[model samples]
Target: MAFLTNVNPALAAYLNEADPTLWSRVYCPGDRYNIKTSNIAESINSMLMKAKGYTITYLIEFITKKLGRWYWKRREDALSLITTFSRGVEFLLALREHYADMMTVERIDGWRFYARGGQRDCLVDLEAKSCSCGVFDVEKMPCSHAIKAVKSSGWHMSTVVEAYYRKDYVYASYAATIIPNVEHDPIGPNIRCIPPIPKQKPGRQKKYRWLTWLELSRKNGSKPRKSHKQYMLVQNADSLDILNLIV
Candidate 1:
């Protein structure tokens, strides 16, 4: 924030005015599950890249087929899981458990414990499923401190982990089937359907599509180059002046 204020005070002020919960995971009320990007949307776009020019009906059909295949494959994978939690969660828990083995847990009460490991000491509450490190509370999964406390108290790891990471939940998520509608013969008199004619705008149409930030960065071999308009803007201009120039 300090760096942003120094570089662009207007951008910093705008960000400060907005609710941090909308942008910062630290302030978010709901669980983020460690995800911090729009990779899901990017993945969908990648899948439909070749189908960009397809007509509406064909595009829908293509997407349905693709999703159906994904559902079937994922359902099969979920069925094969013998563990209580998903593979990813199980792997993470196992890794944390290894670290927890090195940590020493001192019972503060029936549910609370003080875990000391390496240079850090953390408070772990088994009943609340939280750790002073903040990882357990945010991830909804036991951190190393919590794991040590759980083991010392002879409590099950499953009791501390959220149900969202369970095999049953994963299986249920992919249980639905995507079925396309079957073609039906028209009973009424056939009427010719035609698309409306497109009216040309006053200006000439663009010859090329605009490149995305990722494309631009890749083309430059690092950061994206500033546009001609951006270069024209005065470097030391105030926020109001910058806005007026942009307008």
Candidate 2:
């Protein structure tokens, strides 16, 4: 909040107004897997950069084709997997087990245990499927502490992991087909498409993006040094004299 206040007062006010659970991974319930960015949307936008400047009809067609190809390929791959859980979940569980190996577990009761890993100590309850680390509840997966407790009690990891990460569930998630609209709006009475109205603003539109304080700082720190000769050549290049310019 202090950081936002110093940089952007509006952003600080907006953050204060919005629920913390939406932004903070620790407070956010469900299988977030610790993601905290719009990189996935950004990646898709980058992939469709060319289509962005196209007409709406062409853009829709481009996206439709891309999605259709992606769905079919993923559907085939999902059907081929015979594992009990998805590969990603299995990998995570394996990693948790590796970390859990170093942790010491003490049984408290039938389903409760105290797990100590390095400087951290977490209460693990198998019956309630929870951990003091808050990872189990947030990720809907057994944390390293929970894994240590579960293994010490002679229980299989599968028994503790969420069923949502099962192979069948993962397969079912991508089973839906993306059906394309074969035809546009019917010409006469059924015309549903509307043309966009041209509304140009008075001033020159902004081409550069507004960077946050953190982004600006990162840019400054990681910025590459430019060649002085190249920079001078580009700056001094004559716009009208085309023939004399270096090819």
Candidate 3:
């Protein structure tokens, strides 16, 4: 904050106004389950980069086939998992356990302890499932400090981790199949469909879509507007009228 104030006081002030929980993992009230990135949509867009020039029908078919393959492969992997936790979580816990072995735990109480090791010291609370280092609180998994504390308290590592990291939960996540639609003949007589005429705007074409006001507000570090459900209902009504006219 001192560095921010020195460089850009206005930006620092803006950040101070915003809720830290929304951006800072340390302050987050809920578990992230160790999923760090929030740009899954951008990742999907990157995956579809090659299909950008394809027709809408072909593009959809490509996406469906890709998703179907992913679902099948992931379901097989999930089913093959013999461990209680998912493979990734199991690996993570193992790494943490290795570091935890070096840590010395001092019992503060039945459910609390102070862990000191490798130039780092942290307070661990087994009852609250948290540590001063914040990893256990946000990820819902035992950090090295918490792991040391757990071992000292005669508790299993599995008991410290959240159920979300369990193999069963991971399997359930990929259980849904993405079946592609079968090709079918049109119900009505065949008719030639012409493409709509394109009107070129009097400027350089935009490479990206314009951000919505909500998105803009978030990007600009401003307060977001409340959602307009009534406005959305009116828009839906208008769309229904258009569909009725087409019918």
The TM-scores of all predictions, comma-separated, are 0.68, 0.61, 0.66
In terms of lDDT, model 1 sits at 0.85
Q: Supply candidate 3's per-residue lDDT for 115.
A: 96
What's the lDDT for all of these models? Answer: 0.85, 0.80, 0.83
Candidate 3's C-alpha runs over 4 A off are 1-14, 32-39, 183-194, 197-247
Positional deviation of residue 219's Cα in model 3 after best superposition, in angstroms: 40
TM-score order, best first, reads 1, 3, 2
What TM-score does candidate 2 reach?
0.61
Candidate 1: 10-residue stretch with minimal lDDT = 184-193
**Candidate 1 residues 1-247, lDDT tens each?**
9999999999999999999989867678997656646998899999998666645566676688799999999999999999999999999999999999998989989999999995589999988888888888889999989999999999898899999899999989999999864584322223323467999898988798899887989987996665544445456659658779779
Model 2 C-alpha lDDT per residue in residues 59-88, reported as the tens digit of each score? 777788789888898778778887778888
RMSD of each: 17.0, 14.4, 21.4
Which candidate comes out best when scored by lDDT? 1
